[model samples]
Target: MVSHDPAPADPLSLHGVVPPTVTAFHDDESLDEETTAAHARFVVDRGVHGVFPLGTNGEFPLLSDDERDRVVEAVVDEVGGEVPVIAGVGAPSTHRTIARAEHAASVGADGIVVVTPYYYPLDGRAALDHYRAVADAVSLPLYIYHIPSKTGNELSLSTLSELAAIDAVAGVKDSSKNVPWLAQAIDGHPELTFLAGSDSLVFTGLEIGCSGAVSAVANAFPELVVDCYEAYADGDEERARELQSTMFEVRDAFKAGGAYMSGVKTALRLREFDAGPLRSPLRLKDEEATAELRDRLESIDDLEW
Candidate 1:
């Protein structure tokens, strides 16, 4: 088990809001490197702590391995040390996942976000071993991604504890909306950093000792999410709650349109980012729904950076 080291003297000890960027695509559905780099620069310039590409929000599963490598390279090059870049390396197979991790490291990513294996719902022991294998395979710090809803596997407390024992597994992006589980994970391991994976719970997670959040919504509204974290860290609980409530409203609006990913793309398009629609089977919202989302997002006067 890897133990959590103190915040590194180097810059990659990610705290505060790190936005999982949405992958932009051209009209023909090819990778839009220009728009993607602009989006990365836009988020970092907006005062986000870091930029995470190729996560679920980035529609990573739909991209080929070479495409993933190209996109990550583009982000790292564009960011150019202005902010840390944590590349997502969650392939369905452990071997491929490890390769992606190595690729991310080679491309100069500061860290990697690895999801639990999705195809076969591995038991606790298998899950533990999978993470251990990946951690051992890479020298870069790893943040385990626990989004059971998508992966169909959960990272139990014992699994987290075991992973925490490893020197390379620095933290987790706990996407399970279960508050009790989050509390137990945080309480059980004081050394590991717990980053909230869901945007709606960023403040609640922070209040309970989460180091930060990897928010999808931050791709559209970076300042709003950053404000929530800053408010809480400044000891202004009232301001934090207010900002969190506002975020919840935005999330609800997202749900009203569709799932958060589709809504996020819609919002970005509304903002003129040209982040193309979700891939097949993840259909875009209807025109009426999109207009409604635009109104809801636009109605919030302070959403801009």
Candidate 2:
């Protein structure tokens, strides 16, 4: 494999609202490819810049290898070149991650999102080696999925700079909840597209030189999310701030209800989609949380698009 620093395209090419779409299941917990694609169609139709599936929000770690690839294929087929589709191929093993990246490429994903290998803590050098190997393995551009809270592997800023120098690393999705770090990272490397993974930071991220966000709230309010970005882009700072605040409120409400992914599924079910039950070790037993989400969504629904 060659190591070449291609001239950065826009330095913010992978911007805007891209949802890590939730996988749909039937009553019996069978993979519901139809509804999964339908939700992708829903968000794309509502005007997102891209679609990502099989992230933490999408239950990637919980899914079988076959399920992961199938979800990517279904979304790609349904999206049909309408929007760039980035599929998460993060696995604890580098071998499995490579296989997932290859499968994503074969299934028509525009790029791949790779989270650092978890379960055991790794130093900067080890993480760099892992990403470099995967970068060499696939031609599709790779975006680092840096969510330490769930993965137990926190990527340091210095380490991130080293990783960014690699030829194939196109961007990063920062879910560390560190605005200062995000701002500093974006400034440090203006070449790699930086995307915030938190909804509350959409406006702040963009304001601080981030291209856009890879969001969970976007699974429900695609239009609203895009509108917020558009507002910021259009120079309506006030409008953008207002929308961001609303999304922050929604985020807090969802947090109050239950966990991250489950609340997102609850939002989908509220809007009349078939988001079905969560997989094992997880259950939708919180009616109070669901009702809270419903009311909050209703308030959002009443907001003018």
Candidate 3:
């Protein structure tokens, strides 16, 4: 089994809230570097374990290669040594993924989270080879992003265990949100740390031996997340459960609106941050849903910023 302390250099391991930060954009749809870094600083100030840029919440696919690199740079520059900055370097092709990973290292990211290639399905061998190549391609700690709902490929148990054996592979951010499945992975492969990727499952994940969460809702309620994780770590199960339920409330409020990522950004804006808007193809236009989101959040007395 791998040590719980995955790496000596990075204190941000598997056991805390790491927000898949919303990418800040100008009204004209260009990247906003200042607002981007500011948001990172804001969350870090709330005591988040780490910051992840360019994941599903960050609008990774909509971003060009250059844009993604610049976003990582801005986030890394802001986060500094406060926490390990885990950048999502996954791309459709292995070549492009490696390029992004290399660029992430150049920009001083402490680690890289590589989601499975999307659009195309992969067999076990292909998936295993893809991760092996990515791990071999870079020296940085590689986190496997298993978000099968968005990415068509799902890493099978065997493939994941095999990939976990690779020394460079540090952990798996299981966004699938399958608690039983995640538990199996956690028990089956002790060498790899498994971070709960869903906001709703953060507490449950920690209960079942997960390191922590890479949450979308954490973008808005970072302190709630940090408190929940700390409560669990401190053995306050009652408080942990309460905060965990509150997290579910926040998650339900966000999901009630159709555009998932957009609702997250909207929540950020509601909190008075300049989180900007979603890019093309994905829009946040539901006034009713947005209002309902506000109502649900406001009802949570203990979930204050």
Question: Candidate 1, 168: how far from true, in Å?
Answer: 0.4
Q: On residues 1-305, what C-alpha lDDT tens digit does candidate 1 reach at each position?
A: 12222244323677889899878887678888778888998888888988889988888999989889988998999995887788999877889999999999998998988998897878888888888898898898888889899899988788788888878887888888999999888878777777888987888888777878899889988889989888887778888888888888788778775776788888777877777767777766789999899788777765662
Candidates in descending lDDT order: 3, 2, 1
lDDT of 3 by residue, 208-283 (tens): 7777789887888899989988888887888988988988788777877676677788788788896677888777
TM-score of each: 0.94, 0.93, 0.94
Clashes in model 2: which pairs? Answer: none
Sorted on TM-score, highest at the top, how do the candidates line up? Answer: 3, 1, 2
What clash count goes with each model? Answer: 8, 0, 1
lDDT for each residue of candidate 2 in 1-305, tens digit (9 for 90 to 100): 11112226533267788999888888888899998899899899889998998887788888899999899999999995787898999999999999999999887888899998999899999999999999999888899999899889999999999998998899988999888888788878877888888897888888777778888888877877888988888888899889898888778766765776677777777777767888876766388888876776667642443
Q: What TM-score does candidate 1 reach?
A: 0.94
lDDT of 1: 0.83
Better of 1 and 3 by lDDT: 3
Q: C-alpha displacement of 104 in model 3, angstroms?
A: 0.5
Q: Candidate 3 has which clashing residue pairs, if any?
A: 14-211
